[model samples]
Target: MKSAFAAALAGAALVLAGPALAADPTGLWQTSTRSGQVEITKCGPDLCGRLVSSEGLKADPALKDVNNANPRLRDRALKGLTILTGFSGGPDAWTGGSIYNAEDGKTYSGTLTLDGTDTLKVKGCVIVPLCKTQTWTRLR
Candidate 1:
């Protein structure tokens, strides 16, 4: 009877500690420039991110997607834009993604790496060695 109780206790502990052990990037994160916050969520077998909120949009209600390369989409609202897509990898490292730069209206190869419990490193590469990285802080 004592062994059974101990086993149940162990199982309960595992259940409680599982998330803490795994590196999960799915959460609201503030961009390094503090211009916007991106919400990362699981999309099928991969991960995707969207611009949920932006300081610029808040300050100017008339802001639109003027920087989009496609002229038709330029009139669309900047909110809820899918800026990151096709990321596929483990919790600690994600690759093979495309990051859309709304400011420049360009896309680049993207990689995401979890730095710690509250920080994420987002890198966009024009080429393998030529990359720009930004540190994002988890909001929740």
Candidate 2:
């Protein structure tokens, strides 16, 4: 009876911990700004995101990375850029990443977390507690 009860308790614990353990931030997500979509994938043990598509580029086929700070990279295309990198964390939240904003050509400290099954809260901070967050939706 003791062994059976212990097995049942372990099973219950697994079931209860399932949701918190299942935060898979992989696949493509549409940014809250509606400017583009990012494909988040596992980069070894960490997570990384790349800009897969952009509305501005879609609107104009001849679009270039004219806003980049680097003059040499100004002629590069923005569609396939890896804007987010170096993220590391668990299923609940990922931190220690940088998200590059092409508009201003600046990279900010980034943290990513799931806000349910379909929404992701992507926070970019200039400093701790001084940040801006955008809710990104999972793409089908």
Top-TM-score structure, candidate number? 1
Candidate 1 — which residues are off by over 4 angstroms? 1-21
Poorly placed runs, candidate 2 (over 4 Å): 1-21
Query: How many angstroms is residue 24 displaced in model 2 relative to the true structure, after the best TM-score fit?
Result: 0.3
Candidate 2: C-alpha lDDT: 0.86
Report how far off residue 132 is in candidate 2 (Å): 0.5
Clashing pairs in 2: none
Instruction: Report lDDT (Cα) of residue 21, candidate 1.
Output: 62
RMSD of each: 2.5, 3.5
Q: Estimate each model's TM-score.
A: 0.86, 0.81
Q: What would the per-residue lDDT of candidate 2 be over residues 57-95, giving only the tens digit for each residue?
A: 788756677888888988887777888898998677899
How does residue 64 of candidate 2 score in lDDT? 75
Q: Candidate 2 at residue 96, lDDT? A: 98
- The lDDT for every candidate, in the order shown, is 0.89, 0.86
Q: Please report the candidate that would top lDDT against the real structure.
A: 1
Tell me how candidate 1 scores on lDDT. 0.89
